[model samples]
Target: MHRRRRTAVVVTSALLLSVPLLAACGNEARPGAAAVVGGERIEVGAVQSKVKAVRVAQERSPQAEQLVKDSGQLTRAKLYDLIVARVVEKAAEDAGVSVTRKEVQTGRAQLVGQAGGEEQLAAMYLQQRGIAPGQLEDVVRRDVLVGKLAEAIGATNGQEGQQKLNAAFSAAAATLDIDVNPRFGTWSDQDLALGEYKAPWITQVTQSQGAPVSGA
Candidate 1:
């Protein structure tokens, strides 16, 4: 009886010691399972997946497709959007701005309007964007809360407010230290045939035509 009791005690102690090691191993196995922002752990995979989905949507656009082919702007834009969203979310939390169901409903209504109505919007988002009707409400709620927090941080209706907001945005953008992967995001208009061109012969041609040149 004494030997059995001692053996049980030893086994219990061993199991207790293994628990922490097991937990550490589990965490190591899932590298991106959690995202640590300001010491808070949010689900990293969830946010990353959402960002990818948005990128996929942008990829479907003709201009976006061409841009992505020349420069990886799609991925960079997605990263930028996520970083900005996370910052805005943090700001909202700091400002104590809360999103309510009613506010989410209002946001959903606005999105529906942009989508051209509830039925059509639902089909379009579901089929093309792979976003469910319910999920859109959550997205809208977060956006609305962020907007409200921004307004609160920099009041909504004055020149001072506008300046404050611009300053705040600039500061936020600076702090993000976004390192855009050039292969995915950098492209010159010359490479894409999208910017203006100087025509040296045009000036002489117009002069020969006797066209009135203002201030000439």
Candidate 2:
């Protein structure tokens, strides 16, 4: 039997909290920022700090070290995240889905509640993870905006519009042409052949194992 190993690109909640770090690192060393996205400048310090935080969290896992060693995989994943964020932000702006301060506060409260109450969750997230209180609100607000934009783009489910929404999403994904860098984690031609041809699960697994994990 072929077993397909799902290669999950793990981005933690802590990274979401460290978005400000993206601007801080950049402005510290030089006069200007490192990267700009959707007219917003990204700070090198912020990106570095966020990456460091992610590494710190991953240190607990054996896979973390190996993943770090894979520089291509790391870079590709980071770029992918940035691109997605920019795309979502642009889409939200186009749709005029504004994220407000009040909405952010509400979202933060809801998150805290979901994490099992404010005090305990705050201590764990703020004290332990070094995430500022305001950062939580920003993350929540961004997520809300993204959701609203997705709904506007017909990416949400409704009884009457389910099929239409599905078709729209499919067309959008096709148009996006999201090509994964082969040096990073990507499905190979062999893997695609197996998956597309509807080969037995076991056959797909065996074929995938023989294929190279990293590209040239």
Candidate with best TM-score = 1
| Per-residue lDDT of candidate 2, residues 133-193 (tens digit) | 4344444455556444445655443333334333432333334333432222232222221
Which lDDT tens digits does candidate 1 get at residues 1-216? 121111100000000010010111124533543323334333444545654564464466444554334323322322333444555565556567776787667556655665678776654543433343544554455445544654567434445644554455444434443332222232121121101211110011111221211110
| Alpha-carbon lDDT, every model | 0.38, 0.38
How far residue 209's Cα lies from its native spot in candidate 2, in Å, is 43
Error of 2 at 212 (Å): 38
The TM-scores, one per candidate, come to 0.44, 0.43
